[model samples]
Target: MKIAVIGTGGVGGYFGAKLAQAGNDVTFIARGQHLEAIRSNGLLVKSVNGDMHIPNAQVSDTITDITNADLVLTAVKAWQIKDIRNDIKQIIHEKSIVLPLQNGVMAADELAEVIPEKQVMGGLCRIFSLIEAPGVINHVGFKPEIVFGERNGVQTPEMEVLSQLFDNAGIACKASRDIEADVWKKFIFICTSALLAVTKTSYGELRELKETRQMMIALLNEIYAVSQKKGVKIKPDFIDKTIAVIDAVAYESTSSLTRDVWEGKPSEIDYQNGTVVKLAEKYGVDVPVNRFVYDCILPMELKARGKFNRQTS
Candidate 1:
C-alpha cells in the first residue's frame, strides 16, 4: 500500500513506522527540526509494546511530494484539520482513503467539507503516545489500536483490505458499525481528561480527590447529556465506563490538551470541550460543566493563538 502521513507526531510516526516496517510505501510529511531529524537520523519509537527504528525514512515537508497515495492519515491536531484539507486532497487519488486519528469527533466532517465525503472515514486512535523529541515518538500506555469505518455504516471492499493490511502490520484495528457513536465514546474520556488543563492536576490527583472526582463526573454527565441530545448512540452507563478508563490509566498521565496548555502551545481546546459547549447550545442542552471548563481555558487558548494581547492588558 502507498501511504502518506501528514503530521509526523506520535500517532503518525508510530503507525507510519509500523506500516513502513511491514514493507509498504510510506511517505511522512513533516517540517522544521522534526523533519530534519527524521531525514538525518530516521524515526525512533519508544513503545511499551516494543521499541522500533526506521533508518533512512522517507520524509518531506511538502505534501505534494506524495501523489496518488492509497491512504492518507491526517494525524495533525484536531484544529489543524481544516487548514490542511487542500494539502490532503492533493495527495489522494479518487479511491484513496483519508483517515483522521485525531482526538475529537469533528475530524471527518471537517475533512468532508472540502474533500469528498466518501473519501473521509470516521476514525479515532486508542493510544497514549506523543512526540518525545523531534523525531522520537513515545508510547507510554494502552495497546495501540484504531477504530474506523464509513460514516454511513456501510462496509466497502477498501475497509476489508485495510483491515487485513493493518493486521499484517501487527496493528489492532476495527471497522465500526456506528463510527459516530464510537467517536463519541472516545470523546467522553478525552473531553473529561482535558479538564486537567484548567485544574492543573494530574490524572491521579484529579480522579483520586473526592471533590475533583465528583467534578469530573459532572463534566462527564454534561457531555453525556449533550451527546444524547445530539442523538449519538452512547451507552447509558458511559459515565461509569469512562471513569473506569480513567482509573486504569497511570495517575501521572495528562491529556494532550493539558500538556499543550501548560507548555503554552496552540491546542485543540476549541474542538474538544469547546465543541461540546457549541453542540450543547445548538441542541438546546445545558452543559454548564463543559461551559465552565471551556471558559477557563479560553484566555490561555486565545493567547496561544496570538488573539489575546497580553501587553495591552
Candidate 2:
C-alpha cells in the first residue's frame, strides 16, 4: 500500500521505515534539518528490535508531494493536528484512511473536524522512541505496537487489510474491538504519569514513595471519572491495572510529556490532563486532582510556547 507518514519523528520514522523496508511505497513528510538529513543520508532507525537504514528515502517537506496515498499515519504531536489538517486534505482522496497515533483521545476528533469523519480512525501506539538526531530515529525501549479501528468500534475489511499490512512489515499490530476504550485505557496511564514531569519522579520512585503513589492514584481516578462521565467503558479495576502497568516498566522510565517539560520543549499538556480538566468542568465532574496537575504544568507549558510573560513576574 502507498503510505504517507506525516511528522516523521520517532513514531512516524520507525513505523514508516518498517513499512518502507517491507517494500511498501512510503513517502515521509518532514522539514528543517530532519528533511535535509533524510535527503542526504536517508532515514536511519537505531532500534532495540533491529537497526535498519532506508537510504534514498522518498521524502518531501511538502505534504502534497505524495500526490496520493492509501493510508496517512499522522504521528504529529496532539497539539499539531489542527495545524496540518488543511495540508492533509491535499493528499487524500475518497478512499484514503487517516490514523492518528497521538497520545491523547482528541486526535481523531481534531482531524475529523476538518477531514471527513468516515476517513479518520482512532489509534494509539506503544513505543519509546525519539529523534536522536536530525535523521536518526532512536527506538530505545518497548516492542512497538499499534492498535486502531473505526471510531465506533465496528470492524471493516479495510481494517483487516491494514492489520495484514502491519504484520507483513513485521510490526505487532491489532484492530481494536473498542478503540474508544483502548485509547482511554492508555490515556489513564499516560495522563497520570505526566504528573511525574512536575514532581520529577521516575517510575520506580513514583510507585515506591507513598505520597507520589497516592497522588498517582488520585490523578488516575480523576481521569477515570471523567472517562466514565463521558461514557467510555473502562473497567472499575482499571486503576489497579494502570498501576500494575506502571510498576512493570523499567525503574527510570518516564513519559514523553515528562521529558518534554523537563527539556523546556512544547508538550501535550492541553490534550492530556488539560483535556480532562476541561471535560470534567463541562460534564460537572469533580477532577481536582487532574486540575492540580494541569495547573502546575500550565506555566511551564506557556513559557515553552512563548506565551508566558516571565518578565512580568
Candidate 3:
C-alpha cells in the first residue's frame, strides 16, 4: 500500500516505521532535525512490544513530494489539523482515505470540512508513544491499536483493505461498525486524565487523593453530559468504566497534554478541553470542570507561543 504519514511525531513515526518495515511504500512528512535525521540515519522505534528500525525510510518535509497515496494517516496535534488541510488534500487522490489519529472527537469532522467527506474516516489510536528525539520514537505502554471506520457506519472495501494492511504489518487494528462511539470512548479517558494530570502531574497522584479523584470524576461527568447533549451514544456509567481504565495504567502515567505543558511546548489544550467547552455552550450544557481546566492552562499555552501579555499592577 502507498501511505503518507503526515506529522512524523510519536504516533506517525512509530506506525510509519512499522508499515515501511513490512515493505510497504510509506512516506513520512516531517521537518527540521527530525526529517534530516530520518533521511540520514533512519526512523527508529523503541517499543515494549519490539523495537523496529527502517533504515531506508522514505521521508520528506514537503507535502506535495508524495501525491499518489492510497492512505493518509494524519497524526498531527489536534489544533494543527486545520492548518495542514490544504497540504493533505494535495497528496490524496479521489480514492485515497484520510484517517486522523488525533485525540479529539471533531478530528474527522475537521478534516471533512477541508477534504472531501467521502475520503475522511473516523479514527483513533490506542498507544502511549512519543518522539524521544529526532529520528527516534518511544512506545512506553498499551498494545498499540487503531480503530477506524466510515463516518456514517457503512462498511467499505477500503476499510477492510486498510485493516489488512495494518495486520500485515503486525499492528493491532479494528474496523469498527460505530467509529464515533469508539472515538468518544477514548475521548472520555483522555479529557479526564489529561485535565487532572495538568494539576496533579501523575495519574497515581490523582487517583490517590480523594479530592483529586472527585475532581477527575466531576470532569468526566461534565464531559459526559456534553457528549450526551451533542447526541453521542455514550453510556451513563462511562465515568466508572473510564476510571477503572485509568486505575489500570501505571501510576506515573501522564498524558501528552500534561507532558507538553511541562516541557514548555505548544499543546492541544484549545482543541481538547477547549473543544469540550465550546460544545457545551452550543448544547446549553454546563461544563464547569472542563472550562476551569481550559482556563487554567490557557495562559501557559499562550505564553508558549509568545502570545501571552504580562501586565504590571
Candidate 4:
C-alpha cells in the first residue's frame, strides 16, 4: 500500500513507521527539525509492543511532493485539519482513502466539507504516544488500536482492503460498522478526561479527589446528554463504561491536551470540550459542566497561543 502520513506527530509517526516496516511505501509529511531528523537519522518508535526504527524513511514537508497515495492518514491536531485540507487534495487520487486519526469527533466531517466526501472516512485511534523528540515517538501506554469505516456505516471494498493492510502490518485495527458511534465513544472519554486533566493538571490527582471524580462524572454525563440529543447512538451505559475506562488508565496518564497546555503549546481544547458545548447549545441540551470546563480552559489556551491580552482601564 502507498500511504502518506500527514503530520508526523505521535500518532502518525508510530503508525507510519509500522506500515513502513511492513514494506508499505509510506511517505511522512512533516516540517522543521523533525523532518530533518527523520531524513537524516530515521523515524524511531519506542513502543510497549516493541520498538521500531525506519532508517530509510521517505519524508517531505511539502504535500505536493507526494503525488500517489493509496491512503492518507491525517494525524494533525484537530485545529489544523481545515488549514491542510487543500494541501491534502493535491496528493490524493479519486480512489485514495483519507482517514483522520485525530482526537475530535468532527474531523471527518470537517475534511469532507473541504475534500471529497467519498474519499473521507470517519476514523479514530486509541494510543497514548507523543513525539518525545524530533525523530522519536514514545508510545507509552494503551493497546494502540485504530478504528475506521465509511461515514454512513456501510461497508465498502476500500474499507476491507484497508483493514487487511493494517492486519498485515500487525496493527490493532477495526473496521467499524458504525464509525460515528465509535468516534463519539472515544470522544466522551477524551473530553471528560482532558477537561479534568486541564483543570487538575494530573490524572492521578483528578481521579483521587472525590469532588473531582464527581465532577468528571458530571462532565461525562453532560457529553452523553448532548450526544444523545444530537441523535448519535451511544450505548445507554456509555457513561459508566467510559468512567471505568478512565479508572483503569495508569495513574499518571494525562491527555495530549493537558500535556500541550502544560508544555505551553497550542491544544485542541476548542475542538474537544468546546465542541461539546457548542453542540449542546445547538441541540438545546444544557451542558453546564462542559461549558464551565471550556470556559476555564479558554484563557489558558489563548495564552498558550499568545492570543490572550489583559485590558486595564
* TM-score, model 2 to reference: 0.97
Sort the predicted structures by lDDT, highest score first.
2, 1, 4, 3
Q: Candidate 3, after superposition: displacement of residue 237 in Å?
A: 2.6
lDDT of 1: 0.90
Candidate 2 lDDT, 100-208, residue by residue in tens? 9999899999899999999999999999898999999999888899999999788998799889999999999989989999999988888965688888998888889
C-alpha displacement of 293 in model 3, angstroms?
0.8
lDDT assessment of candidate 2:
0.92
Q: In candidate 1, which residue ranges exceed 4 Å CA deviation?
A: 309-313
Model 2 residue 160 CA deviation (Å) reads 1.1
Error of 2 at 92 (Å): 0.6
* Collision count for each candidate, in order: 0, 0, 0, 0
TM value for model 4: 0.97
- Give lDDT tens digits, candidate 4, residues 208-271: 8898888899998988898888889887988888878888888888878887777778889989
Estimated TM-score for each candidate:
0.98, 0.97, 0.96, 0.97
**Candidate 3: worst 10 consecutive residues by lDDT?**
192-201
| Runs of candidate 4 exceeding 4 Å displacement | none
Better of 2 and 3 by lDDT: 2
Among residues 3 or more apart in sequence or in different chains, the pairs in candidate 2 whose N, CA or C atoms overlap within 3 Å are: none
- Per-residue lDDT tens digits for candidate 1, residues 174-225, read 9998999999999888996568988899999999989888889999999899
Give the Cα lDDT of each candidate.
0.90, 0.92, 0.88, 0.89
Best by TM-score: 1
